[model samples]
Target: MSQKDSNILDLLKGNLVKGDKDFELTDEECIGFYFSAMWCPPCRGFTPKLVSFYNKVKCQGEKFEIIFMSGDFDEETFHEYYAEMPWAALKFDLSSIKDTISEKFNIIGIPNLVIVDKAGNLITTNGRGAVLKQFGETVSLTWT
Candidate 1:
């Protein structure tokens, strides 16, 4: 892997939380980095749809994962927002790492979803549109 890929792996391997417990990504082939915030109106509208999509894909046994990258202003709001998500998140304390990830992905707006593969290859930066269009299985098949 290139140095940038190595850095991405290292950043992802750090602390992650799912619900109230610690969690880790294993053999998932497709990973979605969801850039969102609790305070953003668009993010608020999209989060539930993403949650439903996440559950649907997982129920169908898709080898996909999502990491919630919060743009929330504080820990309390972050946790409040994260609690509603079923997928894993970069730990609330790792705000700097979250910022680095946002910069790496060139996330310019709320409610963006950047899809990547296991080897840190870009799948699609317009993941939000894919999800919005409900291209769950069809799009997921391309990731692997």
Candidate 2:
């Protein structure tokens, strides 16, 4: 199991995805989540940057993903707005993590990005840097 998966397992008590109760995260993928809002100007600006960064990471064969946490509107609206982001998003059971995601991740605003290790522990708040610095020997090793 990847280190990130192990960390998230503790929080996987209920379905993280909607309509898929049997779904379980694998141990290999590093998860990224973006806390955003439809009306939040910062979120709108950062979404493109975040999406650009995410695509680069994926293209480099990095085992990482994102779960966009919508701070406004319902799941449908969230999906409609971010229909092209190259990562998975939270579906049902949003209330389960609304406060927890805010407090646990110390997220007081939108466009916040949190990077977790394979075990789901905090790796970097600078996920954009991780992808940018992937050419370095140490960083490449850490993610690979």
Candidate 2: global Cα-lDDT?
0.61
Could you tell me every candidate's TM-score relative to the true structure?
0.88, 0.70
**Residue 86 alpha-carbon offset, candidate 2, angstroms:** 1.7
CA lDDT of each prediction against the hidden true structure = 0.83, 0.61
Question: What is candidate 1's local distance difference test score?
Answer: 0.83
User: Per-residue lDDT of 22-83 in model 2, one digit per residue for the tens?
Assistant: 34456546777677777788778677766776666567787776776777666666656667
Candidate 2 all-Cα RMSD: 5.9
Candidate 1 — which residues are off by over 4 angstroms? Answer: 1-5, 135-144
- Using lDDT as the measure, the top candidate is 1
Clashes of each: 0, 8
